[model samples]
Target: MNKKVAIIGGGIVGASAAYYLSTLPGGDQINVTLYDDGVGQATSAAAGIISPWLSKRRNQQWYQLAKDGATTLMTLARRANLSTDVYHQTGTIVTRTNEKDLHDLYVLAQERREDAPDMGEIKQLDEQQVKQRMPFLTRSQPGIFISGGARVDGAALVEKLLAQAQQVNLIVKRERVKLDDHGKVITSMGPQRFDQVIIAAGPWINELLKPMGINVDVRPQKGQLLELSIPDFPNQENMPVMMPEGERDIIPFGQGKLIVGATHDDEGQFDLSITPEATQDLMTSAQAFVDSLSADNIIRSKVGTRAYTSDFAPFFGRLQSHPHLLVASGLGASGLTTGPLIGRLLAGTLIYGGTPDWSNYEKPLSTYLS
Candidate 1:
């Protein structure tokens, strides 16, 4: 009998890890099972923007992971003969609506080294130029910075990955997991023993591992988003746009719909309910950029929770005492952008001889283990 590995959570991270693990040498001899209650529905809710250059100021580990993960997703789509259209690399335009914000953006741009190739160009666009590029804008914002970015239908990508994993005989289970002292996983659906287990359950990771002595600081941050339909706008298919309004981000995605969102609310207490206050705030912010945006154009709305760590960096690699257990969560808002590469790194550490070098990413297994 071959060694079995069980993974918790069926979101992008879990699915990507399963897919990558299946392709490894002697991977056919290993049994891989993925467990998730809600599967890809909960934590994956987002505009799924793949902007590697947008998160330049983050920790070095996260920056490298986001860059590599975006590349990995593009490569996977191409190799699977899936439509490259799934990844819309139209680039992004980030605007600064005020003097203070413009100064901040300038400072951020100046910090970049001239030798760095991942950084996008910081250029100013006048009112006429801004309108010419994005006709939906009623008036020009103070300053606009256009950069290389990409977007994807996150739900569609998950579906494709699940299908691919099924083709390779990876088991998919929808259930809550119960773990024993020896790191064996048992669920209501069935009981299975594995040599190694990976917990990628996002915000729910702590809830599941509290009994195992691995206390992680993963908290849920709720984000509310609205999809608007407006066919009258020009350059609708150009690419996604990111506007810096105070500390909030207004991102656009899909057909004529714009994903105006995101509220970092810790007071809500992990509830995934969309509050009217958040909805109103998002709509008000959206109108600041596009005056024509209204409640009537709102087609649908949803609220999703993202997992964040105290240090804002993801927790990966095996546990300190429980060598058979591994963890991969706390990706925060960058899960879509960093899922694949993290999956690759985690799978390599779990299945291969030891930890593998991740180029620019420096979160080695040693950093997590004592």
Candidate 2:
């Protein structure tokens, strides 16, 4: 008999899992059912930019995972015959407005050792050099570092991956999941049994799995983002720029529109209301880097919550008590950058009998449940 796998959540993480699961050896013998309440409306939708360099400081293991994830997405796009326009290869520019933060950035750049292959040497850019590379930047800051990175349209990537998974016979279900006493998964729309279950649900995973004795300390970190439709706003040269103010990032996605974002609030709230204060804060911080960004040019704005782990790292690997259950959550703000690699690791461990060294990756479930 073939083994069946039930995946909860249809966002990037879950969708990536289904995609990779279909590619493994004897993968055709496995059946994958992906469950989601709202199709990519959570952290996946809120992902502004995907960059390996920005996430490099997290640690070497995470950096490798993120890099692999990005590479996998690019490979998938080519194989699927999809347009590569969704992924912008323009590198990011990390600018410093405050001297203190500038010093810290230099220290971080210096501390990167030779063994870290992913974090290549950070190249310092002068005002003219920065403008030469990314003319959209106003160059109001004194110091800027150009790091090799890439950006992806998070929403588009999710849709593309989901569509590709469907092509491979992966069942996609749009419904919430509930687990039984024996740790069996129960979906709101359908009743199905599986040999294995993976919970890649973002912010709602904790609540959905609590009754099954799987208490994930994942909290919702809300982020508010805005899009601008200024036609004259700089073109493709507009690279991803991060400002010291509120640690906001200004990302350009090719066209006249730009993605200005992200306020991190630990209140664990799920309301998508765009507050006046957040809107003003985003506009103020955005203007610091991109001088042309004004409130009047704003086309759309919304809020979304990302799932944050206690250690700020993702939760991967199988559950100790319930060996059949696996998890890949707590991606926080790096879901788009890390989802593919983590999904590959999770699927490899579960279906292929491979072992994943979770020493660097957060294993909160093992620590608490074991």
Q: Evaluate model 1: give its TM-score.
A: 0.86
- Per-model C-alpha lDDT, please? 0.69, 0.69
Which pairs in model 2 have colliding backbones?
none
Q: Quote the lDDT for 223 in model 2.
A: 77
- Tens digit per residue, CA lDDT, model 1, 1-370: 8778889987778877888778767677778888877732444566666665544465877776776677786677676566544566665556666777667666665464243344456666655665666676665565545464666656667667777877775888878887765567879856677888888888887777766665666777776677777664555666446555463455555467677766667676467776888878888887876787778988877776778776777767667678788788778777887887778777778777564555466465445323
lDDT score, residue 29, model 1? 72
lDDT score for residue 237 of model 2: 39
